[model samples]
Target: MLHLRAICPAERTDAVLAALKAEPGVTHVVLLRGAAVDPVGDVVEADVAREATDQVVASLCDLGVDRDGGVTLEQIDTALSDAADRAEEAAPGDGADAVVWEELLARTGEESRLNATFLSFLTIACLLTAVAVVTDSPVTLVGAMVVGPEFGPLAAISVGLVLRRWDLVRRAALALAAGFPVAMLITAVGTWLGSRTGLFDPDLALAGHELDFVFEVGPFSLIVALLAGAAGMLSMTSAKSAALVGVFISVTTVPAAGYAAVAAVLGQWDICLQSIAQLAVNLVGVVVAAALVLALRNRRGQVRDLGRPLGNG
Candidate 1:
């Protein structure tokens, strides 16, 4: 369920109330009038079901509430009201079952653009990976992977596919295609310079390393990426950004990129190709897994909508 706070002039309160009353899944309407010192209007507070939030918000907007004063709706993440609990008791599935493709797309935010934070994250990931390779530490390599912020855009691409947002899809694809190569190139140059300074010795290259954990692509890596992608999507949709740290560690993208750079610096062409392949496999696995999760969740949402006459459509 969602809680909405709408501020409008007292005179227009009737229109706003009328609009809210007409909308489905809107209940517990409370009006607090003449609260503002500037006396712009009254404030209307209400609880709305998650399924009906979009329509209710749209209805409020149509009533010119936004222009006259303003309407703000925030999702209530706490315990539900008695009425909502009763409704949920009557319903089989939780609100998450009603997460439609559109809702997911909205949660995805602006995928058509790359923000500074994302770019900075990529840069840091690349830099960290270079440092890890030069130091020949698997721990540092994993640290670099966990620090990378490329997963958001990757998840955005999957959300785009499930929602059929071609703009999102194209932007995500472009970001991935462009971002990885650029990062790899930068890491490669950094690795080369590190080699020249005797910071990274050719003997420590991962190419002929016997450790099964260091340079091999296996089922374990695929599983890790799949899990990481799922967790990433959950974190993104819930807006719990802190979980991304664990996700970065769960995937091998940064480690593989680092390995590729290290191989390039040592002039090990075969190992470089193998590392690149590992990175590609992990990327594909994460995206595909995320897409499948979104698709299934969307299908469940459709089913729930069919069962309820909430006028959400």
Candidate 2:
């Protein structure tokens, strides 16, 4: 179940309650008249079934309740009420298949931030990949894959593109554009310093084909990336976060950057260019596949919601 709290102007209070009462998947309605101080409005709260969240939120947004007031939605750990059960049963689809647009906006926006933590994780993942490159360590390469933080921005790009949110698309693009180069540069420098100090082998790097899949741009690479992107987006929409880690391991963005850095340090220009190409291919595949998935879902949802668009909600 989802808990929704909305601060609505007193003038809109009756309409807000009307919307909630109209939805069969909403229950436990509570109204606190004149409870809102910040927005100086009435407070309206309700328990909504997960599958009906998109429609309910859209109805409120259409009322302009979010303009003069605000809406906050969250998950309820436990709701031991028959009304909640009836609401969930009345909802059209399975809860696990529903996509909450507002929740996704917040999640993807946070992921697309090019902050210190994002930079550090990308750089660290690439550094680990560089080490894996020198040692030809498959386990360490997998570790680097797991440590990469590019998933969020990639998801943001997919969601943003589908929703036609240009600002979000540009923001996520900036994060990737700014993040990869920085990580690669740092990894390259680290590799160079390590080689100079006898901590890494430039010679061994020449035979580093074990991790070459990262730079081996081909049809199969794009296929894997496309598959990973679809799965990753589905995981986010359905709130099955555990699946995202697997998607991370499937994509080769961080590993490619790591390989590019090591190859640059070893003076292997061909491999470096190929690695960058592979990285671009993988990112493109992920973005395209995820956008397609979201677009399809949105279109279907429009029909299911009786002309109300789901993505824009």
Candidate 3:
């Protein structure tokens, strides 16, 4: 279940209440008239089923509650009310399958920014992968995968394409374009430093290692990427996010890029090209798969919203 709180303008309070009362998924509606001070409006609150969160939120936004005042949503860990159970049963879809696009757009906007922190994390993740490659350690590679922050922008790009948000698509594309090269360059420098310090041996890097599959770009790689991307989008939109870590582990984007950087610094042209291909394959596969999943869910959400009224101008 989800709890929603809205500060509505005096004139829109009645419309907000009517919208909530009309939705079968909403219950326990509370209206405190003239309770808002800063926003100078009424305080309205309601409990809604998770499956119906998108519709209810869309309804509130349609009434211009968000523009005139504010709307806040929080998950309810424990709602012991029988009314909450009844509401959930009345909602059309399963809660776990619900897609709240507004929340997703907000989250991806924050995550996909091309800021110092994002660049730093990308650099660090690639560096870790470089170390893993030189040492031929699967554990280190997995650690690098866990630390990589590239998935945010990739997912954002997919969502942007589905929603036709050109700004978001451009922002995410710019972040990836700038961030990856910078990260790879830093990783190359680290590789040179490590080799100079006797920490990384070029012979060990060139020799076949147990983790060689990280460098292989093939149909299998694309299949793995597609699966990971689907799982990733599901984890993002659904209530359970625990599966996200598995998606991170299943992808080879960071490791492949790291290998490419290290191979380039060591003057191994063949390995460099192969690693680059691996990185490209994984990235393209994920983007295509995620876009499809989001597009399908978006269609369903739109179908559900067909008769909804537009927000006040």
Question: How far does residue 147 in candidate 3 sit from its true spot (Å)?
Answer: 0.7
Per-residue alpha-carbon lDDT of candidate 2 for residues 121-232, written as tens digits (9 for 90 to 100): 9999999999898888889999999999998999898887877777778888999999999999999999999999999678877594678788989999999999999999
Name the lDDT of candidate 2. Answer: 0.88
Candidate 1 all-Cα RMSD: 6.1
Weakest ten-residue segment in model 1 by summed lDDT: 304-313
Kindly list the per-residue Cα lDDT of model 1 for residues 174-291, writing each as its tens digit: 7777777777788788777877887767676553333225357788878878888887776655536588788878787867776787678788777778888778878888898888
Clashes of 1: 2
Worst 10 residues of 3 by lDDT: 304-313
The residue ranges of model 2 lying beyond 4 angstroms of the native Cα positions read 300-313
Better lDDT candidate (1, 3): 3
Q: Write the per-residue lDDT of candidate 3 for residues 1-313, one digit (tens) a residue.
A: 8899999999999999999998999999999999999889999999989888888888888888877899888888998889889999999899999887777777777777898999999999999999888888899999999999988998989988887777777888899899999999999999999888988678778688887898877889999999999999988989888998999999999999999999998999898899989999999899899998888788644523222222222
TM-score sort, best first:
3, 2, 1
For model 2, what is the error of residue 275's alpha carbon versus the real structure, in angstroms, after optimal superposition?
Answer: 1.0
Full candidate order by lDDT, most accurate first: 2, 3, 1
lDDT measured at residue 253 in model 3 versus the true structure, 0 to 100: 92
